[model samples]
Target: MTQGFSPTSTRRGTLAGIAAGAATLAMPRIARAQSEIIRIGFPTPLTGPFAAEAKDQVKSAELAVKQINDKGGVAGRKVELLVRDDKLNAGEAATRTLELIEKDKVHAIVGALSSAVQLAVNEVTRARGVIYVSISQSDTINEVKDFSRFTFHEALNPHMTTAAVAKHTFKKGSKIAYLVADYAYGHEMLRGFKRAQEALGATSVGEILHPFGAADYSTFMPRLRSMRPDILCICNFGRDQANAIKQAVDFGMNRQARIVVPVLLHNQRLAIGPEAFDGVVGGANYYWGLEDTIPSAKAFNDAFKAAHDGAYPTDYGAYGYTGVYSLLLAMQKAGGTETDKVIAALEELKYDVAKGPQHYRKCDHQSVQSVLVLESKKKGEMKNPADLFKVLATEPASEDILRTCKELGFPA
Candidate 1:
């Protein structure tokens, strides 16, 4: 574990700095100065239900850092990363982010796994004028009230992800039900599902809100089974998603309804097993299966596998690489770590890193990228332990799936 930051320790560090300065006075000024390194903060839930996903995120991010440093870094300066565990709590996320900024002096931040935790970290970064690229999904963060010039969302929002999933999964007159997580993430996804259901002439039969870390979903299964909807959308994430789908299948819910996940995670799929997720349709930000078609995908997969003992990157894990790589590339284009210049470069820059071409939208700073429609393969169809999903469709990146800036309360 890294050292925990405290106000008293910060004061002690200051005194220690003075003594070190006195000791280093006889040394060369160039050797004494430590301004040749760039530090970016990475805060994620490294010790909670999302630990598996978080571990993959850190590994990919470390790969990005290593790749950049191998290329002599941006403008000849070495890059450093400051990692902290947020524990999946909003308040804890905010506090750790504060330490990253006030204590460690990170130039930018580029890691978050949960919607609420990202928003909490954003608040701290915004107040301090630090550049933050959120790699988590949340529609509320795009609102004008919550967004800032320094904030950029590299992850797909609920609006874009759910629209793609709903279009392909729902049909006319289909009976739909939602098992929501009762948080910002689940609420936003539920809202998107409702909009799509209405547009497609579908009927909403039932909607149930469960707590974030629900261990057992047997109680909710009865109500969902009674509804008998043709489509059941599981609107939870992380370990909650794994347990929900497992219990739902055990209750014979999938026998009657088509199970759909708005954001299908590779880590969650491995946890739920093939038997539980077979025939499950959902949307994903990135899937290793795309390496067959996209050159960028192949490049990322090859590099990540070489670095991580031949293991592939998960759906959300790719965000960690994309988010940090894009930020450093922007800094290189801007020729410095100046916040305004980096933001400008990011706004105008476009590149294909992992999932084909993508760029940040100017209005809300949301990453405009493709959403992959994936179906979990049956156990009999598996070729390898990592080969899980088959890409059914690729919803090309466009503004059609995104909510208009006007609808997000932005000025016309």
Candidate 2:
């Protein structure tokens, strides 16, 4: 990986309080006629490796609902978000979705961060016929085994995210090695990057997957040193990623190869510091600095800061906000919350989000929006703590990259 490859990097308790409060919520769950509220289920990993980003997502969704309700709600019905903690487990995600749908009577659901959790949630929501709108980047969330007409994704899939950054990587160097986790999302991430490297006439040096939550990457680094690939395409998550990047920095691995962290977030920058992540390229869903490109993006950052003690927006929050915001617009357009009507409206829904104009590609229900390819600014280049990434380009989604349901062997 070249230093200029592309786009693109959690907490714990006090965590539970944030989760519980967001569940009951600040978006007015105030007393109203039962029929006056439109319920959307939000299931997320609130207490694991995924906590920091997932909470940002769920709270931002709450903020969107508050904004919608403040403007007289979706379709004149106040939106009520029903929250559940999936605990980063697939079985837990399934049970949470079931409870949200069958017991809480929510009309739709937004899934958790983990692909395995998302697969479970998709299974439940599809069989039960509740609307599922996701920002989960894993391609298989809507794969043939689990896809349903009721589901729509607002974020780029793993393939799209990887390719967005990979195109830029091809311009930098060849002979790539992958450092990934060992799960569904990781497998998809590896597969996507592999295809990109091969397509760009690059040769893969090797691939290594560290178990989730591995405290030390002591073993992986020396092997990366030995392989001597020009690029290190990382597909690990949470603390695992932070640990890997930190160790790489300490070991001066960047002298050996460039780093590419697919799906970087703001919190990661804070956790590991700029020196550690220096010269890395990342594929990301949103960046706070996008406020410069998209006017309303500034509005979101301003509001998010005011609400959270001057905190900044992450890609997770950006996608979650856009997803909920568009869902509300689709409902309003449909004139009712009836499933078929809303689905029809969403298939053509166009809304200006933090990332300019966004519309759903009907065949696969994936949002056709921009994915940011960014390079991490060096410690000296940083204007402040929040100014982590210097935007390379906000690449537009192309039909060539986003595979359709039919191509993925899903029912049309």
Residue by residue across 1-412, what tens digits does model 2's lDDT show? 0111111101112322333333443243334353568998999988988788888998788888888899988767889888799999877787788678656778789757877677667656655566889878778655654456888888778888888888887653488888899987788889888877777888888888888878888788888888888888888777778888889878778888889888776787778888888888888888889888788888898888888889888888776788888898899899768888999999988888677778888767888878889888888898877899988867785666687768787667
Task: Report how far residue 194 has shifted in candidate 1, in Å.
Answer: 0.7
**Clashing pairs in model 1?**
none
Q: Which residues of candidate 1, in runs, are more than 4 Å off?
A: 1-35
lDDT of 1 by residue, 1-412 (tens): 0112112335334433433343345333222133468899999999999999999889888888999999989888889988899999877887788778666767899998998789778766765667999999988778876777888999999988988999999999999989999998999899988998899899999999999898999999999999989999999998998999999999999999999999888999998799999999999999998989899999999999998899999988899999999999998898778788999999997978899999998888989999999999999898999999999888998877788889987786
Error in Å for residue 290 of model 2: 0.9
Give candidate 2's TM-score: 0.89
Q: Which model scores highest in lDDT? A: 1
- Number of clashes in every candidate structure? 0, 11
The lDDT per prediction is 0.86, 0.78
